[model samples]
Target: MNDSLQVIPLRHVDAERMMELISALVSSAGSGQAQGGNNQLKVIADTSSDRLLVKGSPEMIAKVQEMVNQLDTTPTRRLSGLRVFRLKYASAGHIADMLRGLLANQSINSAGATSTLESASLNDASSTGAAINNAASDSLGSSAAAVSTSSTSGTSTGVGGRPFSIIADETQNAVIVNAAPELMFEIEDAVNQLDSRRAQVLIQAAIVEVSGDDATQLGVQWALGNANSGYGVVNFNNVGASATTLAAAALAGTSTAGISAAASSIAGALIGIGDSRKDSQGNTEFYGAILQALDSSTSANLLSMPSILTLDNEKASILVGQNVPFVTGSFTTSGNNSNNPFQTIDRQDIGINLNVIPHIGDNGTVRLEVSQEVSSVVPGSTGNASGLITNKSLINTTILADDQQTIALGGLMRDNTTTRQQKVPGLGNVPIIGRLFRSDNDSTQKSNLIIFLQPTILRDGGAVASVTERKFNQMRVLQLVIDKNGTIKQLPLSGTEGWSGNVSADYELMPLNPLIPKRDQAPKSTSQGFTRVDSPNSGITTYPLNR
Candidate 1:
């Protein structure tokens, strides 16, 4: 057999179905011609572009082509036309129901065939009954035809047709119909008549005070009900960190340079928190981490510290302080044997350093790392020599959160401010009998800083509206009142005698208000209680305020 390659182009057929058909043909041919071997025939289908390539002996290629031709010639139902229409704000189920109602009893002509209206009607009734029964059975989970009939009789008022199929494509937000050309036109008309106007989705965000007298100063209040849209809000709090011991170790016989170097390293780590890149929301992973760490604290002692204010001339620093030991030695010249003074060493200063780094994830998760170091000098037992004590703590973690969701990082407790009052500079230092000339006052303000982060995911109006409507229905009426005016008021009703009391009095006996016109000049009252009056000179129409 001579080797040959052939390409077959197919149209009006799904590539997937074509591939399956070819596979079946190959299997059958292979069984009949076992001598050809399993690999004798090779077929490649480029489903991406919908084409089939065959490589084999000429005999095999010809056999494949014959099968394709036969398959192509087989008769099948042909769609006269197709119409695709979007349901917009409508659901697929609703469009399906509408189509069922509009297209019921419509005649469907098969390919190269026709049907009379009478026959179509008869078929429609049977098909309608079957469809209703099927729907009822599926919904009710009952097999009894009588049950289905009774359940559907009230709801299934329209006839059904077998000539067309309605397909709801939810992903595409559209409905597609396959029917005769005339039927397609009718479907299009019916769909156009359905309401497709989409409602607006409104998303709102605010930082609200959950509690405290200062709550009013915090979040912005909004009336979302009056607007015909949906709404959402996100609340976030400040970020904070707690002071925790990072490391505790004694440093003896270690050079001062070595201790200083370690302190510098720890400081670098803490200050490096600012190196993280900010996300679209202008938040860095470091900040997020800090917020998370602060939030995870279970004890008040582990809370974050309040922020400090620095004067313009002074620079703010995260490296709080580092204390180094001082050493001195002296010789005594006048004592017996001209001996040196007793050698002694004293160490008392402590050192502390803190560092925090936060990393933000793409999915709004935050990873935080915190490093702290503390050091102190301990006196040696033998002489004036001193040893160093150091402590360090490090934390790293990740947390997941979305918009309107709050993540607590940490808390801080400290004296936020100090106030000092003194008399005139010269008199402030007076003592004893001079006490009357001087006065002094000192005060410390303590505060706790908590970090709260709330993220709000902004979405398209459609989605926002849908969510807002479904979740905030109760607010709608309230919003209307809010929109009318910033406040709600109750006004006294006029002409309430009949409503307040059981008796109705004649107008002739009732006292007239000086502000109102006389009864004869007033507009005639209609049965509906509205009085329309016309001015002959001004040609202006007026109505009485009181019904």
Candidate 2:
């Protein structure tokens, strides 16, 4: 349907009516008088100039013809179409200048690069390096050049008489250091640093910036064959890969209570504190887990996963006992029962779950800053306790770039032991001799310490006095962007897309409004044509379906 139409100004036509007419004309023409007959329509217009170009078929021509007849008596109105916006940056040229200035002010290269090569060599052109060293040494003080070899056995000419040459083999590449060895090393090191820096930049760009094919490849690489790593619980008793016994492992130790317990821990880890992700005390929650659901081989695979925060052998065993679906194996003990009473531990499955805490964004997307709360229960034992102490003080640690950085609002908790003591006194008796004789075992603290990462809106505590619960609730959602340098920045996503840009599915934009209804996420698809059937009993004619 490629029919064209030309029209003159009309006294009766208005912009709205003209648009409607054009739409009808285009639709009628494009249908090719085939699919439901004559329903084709496609038009392009220049919005600002009120210029219109219409294209379609015979029926569309007839429709436009009717519109032209009406327009002959009406006033022509301006046409509106797809808008082409010319974005004008407020400080376009100045942005570059400003960035350069900032870079200069920060002395961009001053931060010594982090990674380096273990050992390396550089190309040497002239024998200037050898000559310079000779010039400094007494042996060749007045000589034009000097001879040297990487290996002690190789011979070299003395000073000025001959053009001194150095011999090197595959084992080592010699640098004719016209300067001191120290200076030569320094130059080589610098070159290596540059190479490492370039590689790092390329990797970061590939993983973080580019989307589509490159981003998918990076994600696949990150996950790799981790799914089939056979780490979960697939290898108990060396079950055959295709054995029917292997399939039975899923239900081996599964019980409603067991699954519920695991789900609880996962839920807790995911839910953050309070109205926002922050807890009552205002901190971002982070969770970790160690799975024991699989055999040693499978355990190793599970640990290899990037999501793992920690993975001890004991934890893996517990996970196995619980019978998580992803893992499969015989839930029976096969090892010696005398040494390890838990030999039945193999047959009698167990599991350890890491809370599924929401990960706060690290980049400049999060508008809030939070102090995390970490719980530790020493489980008052007669012997010394070994547990991590977090949130007591900040420590230096590096987070790898491949890890997840999504903000979540949940957590999980699981109890592995049932042993309990009613009371214990003098739990901290002096030294070895006191411990043996101490029977006052009342109120000995027991149980695991669960540390949750918390998020907070206040950058500094001073604003806490002015903050109301309503305001806090209003700021619950957050967006963040993180760079490889470990710099965390908060970017408020309350407005249009914020740091996430125009991509709709990448992130969920939730505004903290108590009164508004919760957002619905349903798939949207194109609708089919309208129906037209009247009441059979009445036999009354109805109007045609126009839209």
Candidate 3:
């Protein structure tokens, strides 16, 4: 064995692949020379920069050089300035896996001339019959398989696979991939197919929660769903309140009879309750009984209670009385109470008034002015005239685009109801006698009302036409002159006209009637105020006299 080492310089061979080959060769030489002597091949590789250096015994150096030479003989292609195609809607991992699959498929079609990194390492190691090196190669192949499985399964952290790097350059709005040029062409083809398809615009929607009573909620839902109202698509969801809370609010003057009515209607609709041929009076009695039972009992308990006939008119009236004062001969005197009588009596009523002003601008701005007024009879008060609660709200604002602007039309009242029921302690439990022993009382109150407003800008044909007209008005006009012959002529009256010479300068004037005689050639006038003229250049001249 020689004591001196040999150095081999390799070119065009990947440093990583060269190092793996050298390590395998050194392992083989070490194991093969272990039993014979202490002389073993020492292999060291310097892979910094582009050059790869390998130092080992002559035989080991010869083996590595042979592998490099074999690699150099294989067919290879080079490409530059190739762009990486990216799918806007696809993820990076998805693109990476697709490229990996494409490479694998192409390798298979080419009879495996281009082997995977793991397989190549295994083949190079197995070429030499060294037990330790073969075992190491097997272990390396297993680890590589595990890593490839993890990467293909979409668990790798970086942009692309281990073999190449795929990066997204947001500044250029493109992706850059470093890989074999031939494979990049395949990727470009796939990406071109993706780009040929059209992209879709997605609509983003939101779910809004509106807190209100049944009537107001139904009205808003209907308005939003109506096509003629121009509010686009809207969906309504009903998440019912707890029965205990609903009943408590109803009984505590915080909820209205409308709520109970709505709940009953919903319950009846759900259960398929049908109307029968019952008289109006009988129907009234049926509803009255239901209300009475529901007033004192829970909704669940009301189902178990037996139905009964009850009369509940639920009518209310008001009376006003006042003492009168009499005036006799401009002197006031107090009148007797018996002589005075009640003057006026009227039922309480609710009044609502609405006013709105909308100003639309040519610049796509909208200004809105809204006013709302509400008046209702106050609860737990005497006399219908003086127990009125009036509320008003005014809003003025400007909004842009199709964005929604909400104005709180508050101060409108929500009817609050208090339900009171009187019943015998034990007899109310009786099936037939319960109706006579139980009575229901209900009172009313008022709470705040909330309103939501969403305004949308309608850019119809007229608006578009106006915008186009404004744009047209902003354009500048270029002046030009046209001649009688239907040809455009340049300014300054150039060529063949008397004013052609230096248009900026003044020209000599010419007489309209140059044939007329001059003052020196004309004859002098006589005492009769008549004169005759003759000129050598003129043909004839005449004069007329006036009386």
Candidate 4:
């Protein structure tokens, strides 16, 4: 009748097992009195909170406490919960595949205390099979991640002992893993590291056309500077090279070599090739060399400025031109003898194009695979024209440089000559005697294509925010200048109060600034802390329990 109730919270051991063990001990240690069964120690397992409610005499409760203390160590049981890791930047499927490759060779020890593997064999990942419960798959909270049943073999894999399974929830953008708790922590750590936001690269480029004389000047300026690495190579591409073929060749560490690069009427001759960077001595070069040389009599003109922003290890491209239709093929059907010919028309893009793929290094260096082209339809080329006259300038190369470094590509030139003679109508037909009244004019001009490129890296969210804010504010300023409304100057651009020196969850789904529209994305209260999530997007969203 005189028993005390003790509530004990557990971290490792399951509450049910703990109670069973203590019940036996209490029964044998209790005094042999004529008390009813109700007098015995009552131990109830609280699996909901992983706690134990124990009622017994003071002495019995003391024993139970001692036993609980002895058993409450870190659990080594080789069973991991179905843990879901929501990814931010990295793809969930990619991360899951990487982890599976890492854990493919893991084996169970003789004692079965832990999962052991020196290294995982990637070859086995494709062939390995696993078994997951259908109920567990169907019960997965996120509808985006519908679980696989027992028939789904590759979702879980094991050589022996308890199987380890990993599934990628593409809709949820999450990686779900079921493994030992000890192994789970290691996998979770890797997920956290891999799921981080990727760095971004912004590339700026300018294409210029200069006279042949200025091209020589630029070539000299480009070659004169001593490279810090002291390693350099020059490449020349053949005329009329396709963009796809040129890029493939460059990626394979080779060049298009079927035809020799002779006097190209289509693509101009290459004038200069070199890296252009600011020197410690502060000598104005690069653009200065091109413009100053053009300032004299070189007749240099900037054609276009193309800029693109992209993630690391990704490709960015910009193209400015017109699409001209050309006949690719002509077909005649035998069934129709009506002299009717069917023609296939293809639209060819003719203009300036710049494409680059950037691979970032940890040392603030970037390796760029660049492909540039300038193509134009000759003065009077039309649809379905045969052997149409076209001009083109193409360059494909890879360069490695420090972040925010500039490089110059030039020397592509085209040559054209014109001869005009004006003569008296009847007198010009008089052969030799007409020469006295006839005037002859002959002129030749040369144009060289020059390209300058610069790549900059944005390492963190703060850096991204700063760059984005600059662009946003620039537009805002432009808007203010054009607006005639009285509130133009008073319009608030102060929505950036979210960003700080340290950016953690600084970017939100809905704008904090009152100017932008806000959605009702806040979580609704439920019996389960956050059992229901109402988000249109697949990415992770944070919700406070109190709300």
Compared with the true structure, all predictions reach lDDT values of: 0.39, 0.27, 0.35, 0.56
lDDT by residue (tens digit), candidate 4, 1-547: 5879899888667788787777766666663232665456668999766799988777767777888998876655434356778888897656765665455532234332213222122233433222222212111122322222244343332332334566666666777678655356557778988888888998888888765422211111111222343422211122222222322222232232411232122233333232234458643122111001111124546568777889998888888998877777888868757778789888888898888999999898989899988887765565424745678889899988788898886556678765555445786568776543344444467877778888889988888777776666444433432223333322233433222212123122122232533364444443333323335442333332221
Superposed on all Cα atoms, model 1 deviates from the true structure by an RMSD in Å of: 33.3
Give me the runs in candidate 4 sitting further than 4 Å from their true place.
Answer: 1-80, 105-157, 160-162, 211-300, 332-340, 413-439, 472-547
Give the C-alpha miss distance for residue 347 in model 4, angstroms: 2.5
The 10-residue segment of model 3 with minimum total lDDT is 129-138
- Give one digit per residue, the lDDT tens place, for model 1 in 1-547: 5668888876545456776888887887553235565347777788665567888777778887887767653234344455667676666545654554345432233221112111111133222211221111111122321221223232321122224455556456676566544355446667877634432212121111111111111111111111123222111121111111101110222234532343342211222111123347543222111112111111222332322222211222344455564444445567567665663455444443433333334564433343333333433533543434443322233344544466664444455333333233564455653332332222334445444433233235665554544343333223322323354322223323222432222121121233456654454553434345344642323433232
User: Which one wins by TM-score: 1 or 4?
Assistant: 4
Off by over 4 Å in 1: 14-16, 29-40, 57-59, 70-414, 424-428, 453-547
Query: Which run of 10 residues does model 4 get worst, by summed lDDT?
Result: 287-296
* TM-score of each candidate structure, all chains considered together: 0.27, 0.14, 0.20, 0.48
Q: What's the TM for model 3?
A: 0.20
In candidate 1, what residue range of length 10 has the lowest lDDT sum?
214-223
Ranking by TM-score: 4, 1, 3, 2
Model 2 / residue 36 / CA error / Å: 56
Q: Flag the better candidate by TM-score, 3 or 4.
A: 4
Cα lDDT tens digits, model 3, 411-457, are 34456665555455685556766644454444454444444444334
